[model samples]
Target: MHKNLSRWREGEQAGRRYAFTAPSPTRYPWQWYWDSCFIAIVRSRWDRERARRELESLLAVAEDGFIGHIAFWGRPLDLERAVRYNVVRRRDLTTRTIQPPLLAYAWRIAVGDPAAEPGIAAHHRWLGGHRDLDGDGLLWLLQPDESGLDASPKFDHVWGPRAQGRRRFPLLIRRNRALGFDLRRVADAGGPVVCEVLTNVAWSLSRQACGEPSTTPALVARLWDERTGRFVDEARGAVHRPLPPERVPFTWDTLAPLALPDLPEEIGRRLVEETLLSERFWPGVPLPSVALDDPAHTSRDHYWGLRRYWRGPSWANAAWLAWQGVRRLGYRAEADDMARRLGETVVREGLREYYEARTGAGMGARDFGWTALALEMLSPRAGSGSGSA
Candidate 1:
């Protein structure tokens, strides 16, 4: 279904060999952390060897235990764009921040090469050591982009108003750059830091996959809001002088914990019956980054002028994540329906960066890579979740 994925493939060799899928050839040439994980998962369907190499390429760029959100492989980079976007150090050509630690999850589901386990463990360790600011078992995000739901309304409070956040975004970039992307400096200087729900959900899954002790799932359970019946994001600050990450918006991010197999009975039930089945999330598109009823939810990604994304669009990766979670929770019928809707949507509209929340129409970048994740949903399964709608 995602045949264009092959067209988005690229490689790097200043001296070493590296190959990975680009989110988009023209728009996003750099390899991203979670994007590669999603790409690797789907890549395994058609080509197992390439999937392995794609992850290997991603790991080759990890510096110490930390893996940057974006890996600017190949020394020849657009220095201006690199600096403007995110580059902790020009020499490393990787961001100082991290994405959801989905490497182990991807490896197990896609390749499971025993050799890659060490790198996976180190990446997980790096996160636990550096990103977990207050021993809350949840990792804190230094920048909004680190959440992979950049520009999501959940973070609008960080930079004042959502619209003003655009102008102030560069200021945040400059501030992080000034500190050389040091965790201690960034956390202490924190105007706003977050313990994002989606990120911790991914971390808990990956950490458990790597056999690391998981205090995150328990902490994530604590984020549940009795009033909303949704788990909210935390806002923990610097390790030097730490404070718990406060509650933020209760967006679709609240549903991420459902992916866990051991999700609490009541929490998972409310998420499915109240949120997923309701009009707010399932109006037309199976799900949106933000809930449909949310005031911040808009049809268009106005926040991003040209590359607008993640505000309210229905992303394939997000759907895939949700599908995996719901299915694991024994909601087989509902999970299959989600896969059917997303698979059908992608078929009707071409693979794009994001889709319209209500119509499932394509939006953002063209020939997107991770949207290829739909292949898994469309694949043959042994049970009721087997076929697409």
Candidate 2:
């Protein structure tokens, strides 16, 4: 894993010494927000200084608490890719969207880097102020990609198949930069907003890492579907207490809230037995991005550059996040089991971007960076993070 991670590392690109690892050398040459966070978590295990510098390089482009998703370091921004992603080399060349706010957790776990605190706090404030269109405890995602479960069927109801809104990824940066990324009028005009599950779970955990308290109204009241026993995306309107059978799409994010420490005892345990450790997601591999019984579920890596990247593959980052929550909730046996299988999968698959959830077949980009998190899952402190933070 370390060898693969080192092979994918990028540094001194485009006349800069900023160092960070690309998710894949061939497929994903650019730096990604959340991918860097996950990689840094494992990179700390090998060399803490390198991990710190990696995050520092990733955050170099952050301004006014707003961080874009991708940074084209060695590559130059061109007319075609620029128009497609809405970025220009001369004018802050990165998309305007944010990924999961995991920097705080990564920094905390990597040993309290104070440099990340202000930006982390400001990023949370940006989300709280700009998102949450309804001010519910749950936050709204202006675009599907912001949740990082890109192209998952869980969002088909919002943007149809393949998350059509992704085409607008670049526009957010232009508008925010024009408006100074200020508190008011942050969201682009006429974009759809849904209170997504994964973003809120990350929000819940990262906010705690910053030592910030959660907002009012409570996520349980807005996002938790008691009837379905999973977290569902809420697109405006109060979720009735009892959701009808199969009322919401079940995807990997269904188990994401398990990472939240504040989750109730009954809720967390049920999430463990009925969902995380259940046969539905644990078909053969430890966890699949989408539940096995979901109508859109599939374990094949049919699409790569096109879309639908997260439908049913087993992602190392997803497993690490679930393992964090599962172990925190006192299900060490199940968490350890997942860690063992995940480490073996990494060994068998050789650090690909994602693997087949059911058969453990390698898929997506090879020498993928975050698959290194399988090692973190096997660490002694793997279960150290709390549902509280």
Candidate 3:
């Protein structure tokens, strides 16, 4: 564990452009929002000053409370590539959409108070206004990539063949970015627009941590499906109903709301009993990104084709969040079991981007930042206690 943590420390970049942990030295090459959040959480356990610096660097680039999904090292070619691929526009160095509002949540944990930070309060305020797209108090994902699940089946249909087809990739990227990278605009473009469950939950948790009012009540009223015992994605715009259960993509992201420490008892209990402990999600390596039974579920060896990315890999970051949520809800035994399993996977597979859900085989970038973060979080010094929700 100490060796893995050393790799993460060695991976840190400091001095000018940004003092943040890169997700990986090779594949990722830049600082990502949520990745930094998790990284800070782990860093706080040992080095509070460095953890705080990591977040402060992110806020340094914030524009009107909107932190771009990723911050590059500002090379001319990188900037040109981002604009050409529509990953980011000329006006901003970051991507078109924001990542999960997890910075505040991590801030409160790393520092004593989230609002104590220079720009955090403003960012929190920015989210309360701009991100509530439909005014239902639930946040919407402007693009599938913003959800951080990327190529998950939840977005397979919404992104369509353009997302998978190499020929159409550039066109799809431009179209999504041109639409302001917003779900409402996608709806306007005759594409499916979903009020993502995980993004809103992360937003609400950030609000709570920052001493802002709770948005979970409004989110529950808006997205929780009492009949289904799960939080379902609601379509944006005039369709004010949760999508059908069959239509809703069952993935680890769908259950992310479970991580909220203050989640209502009834809602959280139903989620634990019906979904988290069920055969669909709790079996095999456990908490597979896509349920094992889902037709879209893919194993690590199968990731080479159109069905790659978040289709079925068990991401340590996702598992860490879920473990924190479960522990917060007083399920210490279950949470500890999950943490142990994830720690073992990292030890056996090395610090990779993610692991195959069932086999625990490492995949994607090795020495991955977030995977190392997870190991640190589960380390003895970090303790098994829950984090700020």
C-alpha TM-score for every candidate: 0.89, 0.86, 0.87
Q: What are the candidates' C-alpha RMSDs?
A: 3.9, 4.2, 3.7
How do these models rank on TM-score, best leading? 1, 3, 2
Task: Report the CA-based lDDT of candidate 1 relative to the real structure.
Answer: 0.72
- Candidate 2 residue pairs in clash (backbone atoms < 3 Å): 260-387, 261-387, 261-388
- What's the TM for model 1? 0.89
lDDT of 2 at 354: 84
Candidate 2 C-alpha lDDT tens digits along 148-216: 887776666655432533454345445544655332354444344567778777777767677777532
The parts of candidate 2 lying over 4 Å away from their true place are: 7-17, 78-80, 86-91, 113-116, 165-190, 215-217, 236-245, 303-305, 382-389
* lDDT rank order: 1, 2, 3
Best by TM-score: 1
**Clash-forming residue pairs, model 1:** 195-234, 235-245, 235-246, 236-245, 259-325
Model 3 over residues 144-205: C-alpha lDDT tens digits? 66677777777655555554322354576787777777655676776545677788888888
Model 1 agreement with the true structure over 1-389: per-residue lDDT tens digits: 55788754555555556788888878788789999998987888778888888888777887676788888775456666665576755666677778887888778767874335777777877887887777767787777788888877677666543212376567778887888766667878754677777888888777666666665556545677678677776654432233223344446777777666556667777888888778878765766987777777777776436344566778888777667657766787877788788888888888888899888889888889888777776673333122111
